[model samples]
Target: MSSLLGSKEATNRSFRSIADLTVLGLLTLLLAALPLGASGYVLYVVNLLMVYVVLSLGMHLAIGETGQFTLSHTAFFGIGIYTAGLVNNHWHFPFPVSILASAAVAALVGWVIGVLALRMRDIYLALATFAFGEAMQWVLLNWESVTRGANGLRFRAATLGELQLVSDLLAYPFVVAIAALMMALTFAITRSRLGLAFRAVRESDMAAVAMGINARAIKVTSFVLSAAFAGVAGGMYTLFTSFIHPESLGFETTVMVLTMVVVGGLGSVRGAVAGAIIVGLISELLRQAPSYQEIIYGVILMLFMMFLPKGLASLVNGRVALKKGCAS
Candidate 1:
């Protein structure tokens, strides 16, 4: 019976793995084909959606997997934007260079914050991160020489030799490619030993420590990874937008990212991506009804939490489970 149970579990794992590969393969095909006939506005919207996917994945790593409650996602995102934009503007480095630098700088800052805030937990941790975000925004607003003080920073077009990504259509393929790469990386991480450590810490730091895990280190690692992903998202933003200001990087942006992760189902990478695409498009459409946008969005989120708290991913899981049971 024990052997039979083990075989069943192995078969289930195989099924999930095959399903994941199929979905990813189809997605890659779409991303590779999208820019062929897409309009300028469609490409622009898709670019932002990809950015949100990266941001939500970052949040999932930190909060969903590591159980860290941080409200400073946009702060790291802003850091990435400015770092990549400034580098591209001043040094004319390739987009990859600027993006990597942004990730490194953001990870460094996240490490600092994680070290300082590790002592706190729950609401205290959230508040502390929120305060840090507000402070970062203030700096972006007041740093006249650096951020251009509310006028917005207009960076040079991201370039790789003769290939210049000035327009949304021009940058669409790269943007989608980067976002897909991040998704694949996230999947790989969640299947590795480090991912097991993250989940153990998330379940209970004290229990994880008792089991010989360096829970604190895992938490800090999550923070750094989360920030790096956000920073990359920011760099992706610079590729097409070419301009940014303090106003766009605020707590609301953080809230939207948080919402995406939660609505997609916490701790599920597939959910985060789907949530980003669905919620990102909805948020974009909500712009037309600025006054009622918040109300409608809030209602939708509340309803999801109330009825489908496990998120859209839960439905997929249910279907998979049903199939597995039928096979058994």
Candidate 2:
């Protein structure tokens, strides 16, 4: 009887593995086709979506996987932007160097926050993170010599490798490629051992600790990983906009990212990407509309939260379950 049960479990795991691989393949094909078939504006939105996709993934690593309700992601995001900006603007470093440096700095900040907040419980941790985010914005706003204060700093057009992309159409593919690679990396991490540990920590930290898992190390690791991803997203945002500002690192922006994760799905990585697309497109579309835009956004978010608490990802799961039921 035990052997039979083990066999069944193994079979279920195999099925899940297949399902995940199929999804990955489909996403790859879709990404490959978009730049070839889509319009320039569509491609531009896709590029923007790719960046948020990374940012949302980072948020998912904390909120969804490790159950850390952090409001300090925007600060980490700023770390990346300012890191790249300072290096490129002053030191004349290469793009890769700036991005790497930004990621490292953001990870350091995450580590510091994690260490200091180790003893804090839920809301306390959230408040502390929120304060850290606000402080980061203040620093950026007041640091005129480096950040240029409220005016922000614009960069000259950048190149990837030897290719100087003068058009958005040209640059769009480059950004998309990097974002896609990062997304794959994130997906891998979500399916690996560390991901299971993250989920365990999220579900019950005390239980996880009792099970011999070092909860503190898991929390800190997830935090640092999330911060690194946020840094990458921020660097991309800066490059795409050709400028960096304190507002990008503010509480409002942090809320925006949080909205993306929550509205998409709590623990669904793919859902986070989907949520970004929905919010990003809706926000851009409503930019020209009347005052109703903000109202519409709030309404949609409320409706989704009420009706689809698990998020749109739940719909996918439901469909898959239905298909399996039919097969069985």
Candidate 3:
């Protein structure tokens, strides 16, 4: 009777934990949706927020989950956008096909980079990746035969096979859907056995290797997957913006994406999402201010690093802890 009672109690605790997490997730959804209640510039900012969320999620998968520090996710994003643009603009292929091709190409490059750099320590890996990103930018800028050199490419209307969708307002829902689906997929991965392997590797690659886990393979897989997700977001970005440029892969853009992940929280998915939204909003808001935005941006980043080092999601988790304490 005692064992049975203990089992039942354990089950109940598990259910309660799941319920709490579900409620928190629903609340996050509600928060994301709040901008929809506004219009014009607000909606535009919300769209930008979604883009950053996707970018940060990819970084979270690589850095937080797999323990790989990449300083050049933006390069993969640029590859995806440019690949999709080339396919769509030159070949006149369907949008879905173009997006997939972009992801595949980016994944291939990511795999190659991972294979080459996995043997190096973190700092060396970072420098190598950064170099590759700079090289990509130079190639995109000077490869006139393909990328049109300094003058970027302009894409025509995007299509879904026989169907064609137009208007930014109409397309907003699709972008949101893609972002949501990608985020959910990321969450699922984080909850699976692969995620466990990733965590083990992150905690200690040597230990993970001792435990019979292929650390190099895990790192490479994570990098490829992260690049693929970033590619999806990039494809969507290019289609929405209808243009592609070499500057998209430059060092500054890379720093911005890295900042989103670091500021949010290294390993937490929620932190990645929160960081992306907050940083994206601040950047867009600063753009509007123009005069004092740079000063404000630098100050905000410093404050985040100094105080809320874990990002806004940490603040949310703290409130949850406080509420549970009160309930108890």
Candidate 4:
């Protein structure tokens, strides 16, 4: 009976996995075909959605998997944007090179923040990171020489050799590819031994240490990796956007990413992706109604929190389990 039950359970899981992959494949096909018939505005929105997906995934790594409350994600994202934008604007380097430079610069800054995190936890860590984010915003706003201060920094078109990407359609393919790569990387990391260590640390650092895991190292590595993800998202942003303002890289942006991760189902990868897409679309749609936007957005969030606290994934999982139970 035990073996029979185990086999049945495995079969159910296999079916669920297959269903998920089928859905994902269909979505990818649809998205790939979008540019063929869609308007430039549609492609632009999709590209922006992909960037949010990457950004939310980064937040998920730090807060959900590693159990770190990091409020400085936008700061690292800003670091990436500025780094990539400046490099491309000055040298007209290829997009790949600029993206890599952005990731490295953001990772380096993340390391410093991670070291600071080692000495604090909970609210103290949150406050410290929040302060750091605000400080970075200030620097971006006041540093008129490099960031162009309040006037914003505009970049020349990103290019590949002689092919200049002058429109959203031109950049869409690269944006989608990079976002897919980040998603795959996130999945791989979450399924590895290091991912187990991250979960263990999240559950109990003391217990993880007792089990011979280097809790401190895992924490710091999480920060670094998360920041790198945000950096890549920023790099992706520069691919399509011509101008970036310092005002856009502040607490409000961080809050939006946090909302994406939390509303998507905290630690679940599917949740993060779905949340980003859904929220991104809603945000874009709401732009048409500027006056009621905040009110409607807040109400939707409040309803979600009150009704589906565990997130959209939980609601879907609940239905799946219910069906299984009914079948049994």
Candidate 5:
């Protein structure tokens, strides 16, 4: 029985590795090929989708992995954007430095929210995070002295030594590279022992604690990881785009990313990536029709929830399971 179980585990690991490589290979190929003849608008849209991908991946870590219903992703994202943009605006350092600073600052703020999350659960935890998100947006809106208030903050082009990212075409490669890196990192984290602890705690903190998993620490770590991803994503945004508004970092943005994670399958990394791209494109396409956008988006959400609550990942899983059963 032990040998059989070990064999089964090994097979599953192989299957997972193949699936991850297939997804990453496809995504990398798709993004990599876009630069050949893609227009500026196409480049911009893809860059924005990459940012959404990172944000959704982060959301998955908290709500999907650790089962923490924190709504502070947008807040962390805003923290990253302002931090990266402001640092670039004021300093002459390389843009990578500014982006790293953004990630550090966002992670620090996320840590505070994570500590606060220890005392709460479910809706209360979500509400607290959401409230914090709102407060941060307010700061971006009213802090005219530094943030330039409601007018929006526009910074200069990002630089790396002598190279300046003055156009979307120039920035596309870096954005794609970073997004790919984040996607691979997410997959790596999910397969690690730390990820095992995250899901264990998600199942039940009591059970995780019994197994010596340090549930509290796991929860905090999930939040930190999520925030850092959002921070990096915000930095990526600064690579192609120079201006940001508080309106762009509001609760609605969080909801959109949460939708991508949920619609893709909460705990599935492939689901997160695929969901972000598919659903984000739909959202972007609908921007031209402002009046019916919300209505259409609402209908799509309802349809998915009613018919495919487990998300697109479940469909793939079902097919894989069926094949295995047939072979057996």
Candidate 6:
């Protein structure tokens, strides 16, 4: 009996390993083929999807993993874009430098918000963050000298010494690479001690505190990390696009990201990425039917919540588990 159990466990692991490799191989093939045959518009949409992936991952880190409800991600994203764009426009710094600066600024602001937010919980925290997001949008719209107000700010093409990325096709590689790096980083975080602490806090702050985890510190760290992710995503935006507008970085944007995270499966790294891609594509498609977009989007979200509250990731995992059970 013992030998049989051991054999089964080994077989399960082997199957899982094979499945993981297969998925990775398919993803690599698809990404490679896309640039070769995809249209410019398709590349643009894919680049935007990459940015959404990073943004949703950040949202996942804060709300899903750390159990902190924050609605200010769009604010951090806008900050990154404007800050990095301004620096790049004036100083002509390389993409790396500007991206880092954007992340740093967003992280710093996030730290301040996190420290203050420690005083609030649940709905209060959500409301506070929402208010902050709105306030930031106002600042972006009214601050003519800095954000160029309603006129919007245009970015000169991003460059690396001699090579300038003036088009989405030229920027696609870098954008995809950055998104992949963030996804890997997020996976690493989820496997580390910090990730364990985040889960603990999410499960129950009191219980986590009893385990000697500094709940406040962990929460703050999650906020900072999430904000940095959003900032980097914003930097990625500047790489592919030429314009930044306050209207695009507002409450609706936050809601879109929140829906992606929730529909993808809250607290799941894979879910976040999947949700971003799926929803991003849907949103792009909805552009053709602007009159029915909101209604359709809302209905889809409602259906998911009603039937798959655990999100799409749960459905995939359920299928995998059923297959393993059959094998056993």
Candidate 4 scores a C-alpha RMSD against the true structure in Å of 1.7
Model 4, residue 130: what's the lDDT?
95
Task: Report clashes for each candidate as comma-separated counts.
Answer: 0, 0, 0, 0, 0, 0
Residue 59, model 3: Cα distance from true site in angstroms = 0.5
State each model's C-alpha RMSD to the native: 1.5, 2.9, 3.7, 1.7, 1.9, 1.7
**Local accuracy by lDDT, each model:** 0.91, 0.80, 0.79, 0.90, 0.88, 0.92
TM-scores, in order shown?
0.95, 0.87, 0.85, 0.95, 0.94, 0.95
Candidate 3 regions exceeding 4 Å error are 1-43, 288-302, 320-328
Which candidate gets the maximum lDDT versus the true structure? 6
The 10 consecutive residues of candidate 2 with the worst lDDT sum are 157-166
lDDT of 1 by residue, 29-125 (tens): 8877877888899889999999999999999999888999899999999999999999998899999999999999999999999999877999999
Better model by lDDT: candidate 4 vs candidate 5: 4
Query: Cα lDDT for residue 262, model 4?
Result: 71
Q: What local lDDT score does residue 161 receive in model 3, on the 0 to 100 scale? A: 72
The CA lDDT at 125 in model 2 is 90
Query: What lDDT does model 4 reach?
Result: 0.90
Writing each residue's lDDT as its tens digit, candidate 2 over 169-231 gives 777766777788777888898899999899999999889999889999999999999999988
TM-score of candidate 2 on Cα atoms, chains taken together: 0.87
Q: Show model 2 residue runs off by greater than 4 Å.
A: 1-30, 36-40, 289-298, 325-328
Q: Which of the two, 3 or 4, has more TM-score?
A: 4
Stretches of model 1 off by over 4 angstroms after superposition: 326-328
lDDT of 4 by residue, 117-153 (tens): 7579999999999999999999999999999999999
For candidate 5, the per-residue lDDT at 118 reads: 57
